[model samples]
Target chain A: MSLDKEKIKHVAKLARISVDEAKVDSLTKDLNSIFKFIEQLNELNTDKVEPLTSILNQSLRSRKDEISDGKIREKILKNSPKKNEEFFVVPKVVE
Target chain B: MSNITNQSLSEILKSIKSKKISSLELTQEYIKNIENAKKLNAFVTTTFDKALENAKKFDNKPNNEQLLSGIPLAVKDLFCTENVKTTAGSNILNNFVPSYESTVTKNLWNNGAFLLGKLNCDEFAMGSSNETSFFGNVINPIGDHLVPGGSSGGSSSALAADLTPATIGTDTGGSIRQPASFTGTVGLKPTYGLCSRWGIVAFASSLDQAGPMTKTVNDCSIMLEAMSGFDDKDSTSINKKKESYSKNLKDNIKGLKIGIPKEYRVDNMPKEIDELWEKGKKILKDLGAQLIDISLPHTKYALPTYYIVAPAEASSNLARYDGVRYGYRSQKGKDLIEMYENTRSEGFGDEVKRRILIGTYVLSSGYYDAYYLKAQKVRQLIKKDFDDSFTKVDAILTPSTPSSAFKIGEKTNDPVSMYLNDIFTVPVNLAGLPALSLPAGLDKQGYPLGLQLIGKALDEQKILNIGYAFEKNCGYKNEIKKWWS
Candidate 1:
């Protein structure tokens, strides 16, 4: 299946990536090639294969599980673009 | 120790303790080398001033006996260093500076390690060849013409170029091993969750692991000792009591059952690489390690499985970046959504955008089960192959990459060919096991060949020991590549 402009837009939106209209056709072709390769995996009989999450069969080791992030507000906020009184500010959303 | 190129952490620390070398000098030297180097392209953003500032504190610290004290170490661009231009090798976050530090880098900094700089990487750690980085591709330090194996290309090149004593690299699909093999340095992708992923820009969260890339196995051990531990912030971080990753170094390799996976030794293999594998096996056998033939039949499907799973996760994780939040905002926008689209479109390079599209498509609701779920199931089969073999052998061995490093532009136009670079290394990642690449020997053309050792989950020490032992014997006439300079 080929990727139409609409589908490209859809996928781009899902990924939060903005796509330029100029190269939509090229992206469609390359993505189709990749999908075609992925489609080859369907030929194998994976009916018996079990889905694995972590490679280790062992359970995660338990922890004390306490909230202990040492407060470093100044250090933590050093990277924020716009912060006001311990919170990040963004464009107003709700009407 | 003056060069810091091939020096071990212990030696560097000793030099520092004796006042023969100061931390500032080490940090400055690496910065100078990085600036002077022609084409290693190892660093993305440098913290030269901060590194020098931090180095001053090393003078007052107690004799804590930390492995990394006063040593200069590079960090992959994917890992966040607070207030540094912590790009994930993508332009979407080109302006993004992390408010906090990655646990591994934080730990490294805490142990008095000088942060040399941020190394270049594949955009969001997606590509194995370093071609996809928003910053121009990283070149192999050993030879400017070759592709520095990546997405940890910068890390390997940094160590290979002697830019830093060691650097931290994350491996999702052989990012570390492939580059290490290409550049003739040591790289490790420790067992999943051995190092915390918090503040490390996520790629495939399940498969991604932060590891060490150094000039030698011992240096890797020293850096690994500093990096691995449990962090409560990252849900996947293992809570196990930390073991000294260096304890197994220089440990005995006698009677160690090493498995040669028959599946990895299939046809279509390059002849020189095949000969190198045979040579690697012989070397191990001579070192008193027992070689056992084993099978991992599901190897062929590993790349496809990895591609699907990694991108699927990547699609979700990367969705956080948009113009609305604290990233690059598009100047021309009729609306917020258009701003996001234009900003991201302008920010990400062609390769980055390509994978983002592919990733989003596979994980989209209608296709999730067909692509992602099936890939996860196949991931299990691949893991089972490793698990079944581990029972018969203490450690498994294979060719790290199908062949030695290819030319820079060889696979750039062909995405499929680039993905195959990680063919041998991806399987172990899917299985979440600790694996390392040792510079086994040289090929006919004087290029390096690597032998990968896969150990049991959390068994980093054993692999370190085996690597340390084998490295001592490679009779490496010249460890440093003459062409590097």
Candidate 2:
């Protein structure tokens, strides 16, 4: 149940968060304790149990997958940190 | 004007119709009430100009007949309101004002529901005690220093304090119901997708549903009627056909069969709640309803399953808050990535950081199968328990929370103890069932007690009918207003 600093950094990378070296030990300690509590599930007799996504057992409803969203170019850029008339700009990802 | 307390949204709307009071007058009075009830910390930010302007719109549009035109309601800060700062009870989004309103708010606005102000809540709607909110703790009007049960704590306390006729609160796990139970107001978490989620700040998308938090079942019906609708923007919005939530409020519950789950009678439960269940059963029986003992064997795993699934989804849902796109940006970072990390690290509070860490762990690559997948499977077993029971009964009755509201800071540090608060209500979210908390009676300690009636999917009316019947059956006085005095 001991999550090392490396393990914490590993998880943080996958979660897109950058964990500081100083805080890694603290998050590691907390995550390990939580996992320790969570490990209790192995003792339960869940051999015959079926996992569920919804209580009513209905499939999720979905709309037609088409580009029908109303155009809100101005509204979309209203809160953007950096935006031009046609699109949002960020630090260039590639040359 | 000061005593416009305990009036339902229907009563306020009626006064507007009869010309007994202008919508502007009603809005101003509640605005004054919100100002006076400052001790409750119920409001995060008030949309004063927007509300008055909207009320004036009602005056000009004589043909408009929306149910809540002039009536003011406190929107839980979790929902995005255009031009209003949606703090989400987090400092990370301290200055984050949404450019668009959530579909639920949009629908309400289309029907002429005026906004009062944003209510305070736990950070990112994470805690059940409202204490984690960056805006500060919302005091329960119950006055025992009891936490107004949270995330939606502000909405519940405001309703209890009569600051507004009603408030819109979201229930993810038991955020709405626990607070409603603690404060003795009517709150509901409708079947998933009953209200559109396009604008709501995500907690757990699969389980989060918004419904009315009100003073009576009838007001809930009216509010729900206005709020519940299918929206194209929300992929999961119910599409079978829209149903009026208020239509069946007056339906007779005679011969209605209610299932009481034996699994819920855990060993050494709070005596106050256990006794209240017995008394509630007697009341239902006397109303000519049959109470059948039932078993939902999967009840034991519900809490564990909910913790895993909700946190997993929450982990994914919260990823959007990195300082780059929106929310708080740290000024101290040396680089772009460092800036995002440091901003989130400093902006999010301790409890939120803890949950984010747990959420990350559960959904991590090495542990996803063992933790996240297994939790989803247990989720199915939990649903099956209710499905099997509903075959023989119309709805299931259970306690809202394990006990009454705890004193603030009592279990805030103990994460497990805090998670245990949603033990009873979490199962409904796992099953995606609709559940409502209605006032049953006072606990021995004189704090309010809530009885939960869970209904089948799209069976919101059935729960509403049962709640209405319970309210009718008890000439029970809604006594707790004395605390505010």
Instruction: Pick the lDDT winner.
Output: 2
Give the poorly placed runs of model 2, Cα more than 4 Å off: A2-6, A16-33, A45-66, A69-73, A81-95, B62-64, B481-485
Docking quality (DockQ) for each candidate: 0.49, 0.41
* Tens digits of lDDT, candidate 1, A13-63: 766666767888878877887777777678778898778866655566676
lDDT score, candidate 1, position B162: 76
State each model's TM-score restricted to chain B.
0.96, 0.97
Write the residue-wise lDDT of candidate 1 on B215-262 in tens digits.
778878888888889897887787788787666577579999999888
lDDT of 2 by residue, B1-485 (tens): 44555577777777778777777777888887778788888888998898888778777663347667667677899999988889999998898888888988877777777788999999989998999999999998887488999879999998888788888889889998999999888999989878888889998888888988999898998888888888877778877676666765765788999999988887667998998888778878888889999999878778777777777888889888876557776766566566667777778887787777677888776888788878877777778788899999998889888888889889865777787788788888888889999888887777888999999988988889888988887655566654443
Candidate 1 chain A lDDT trough over 10 residues, lowest sum = A74-83
Which residue pairs of candidate 2 clash? A51-B377, A51-B380, A52-B379, A52-B380, A55-B431, B102-B199, B128-B150
Docking class of 1: medium
DockQ score of the complex predicted as candidate 1: 0.49
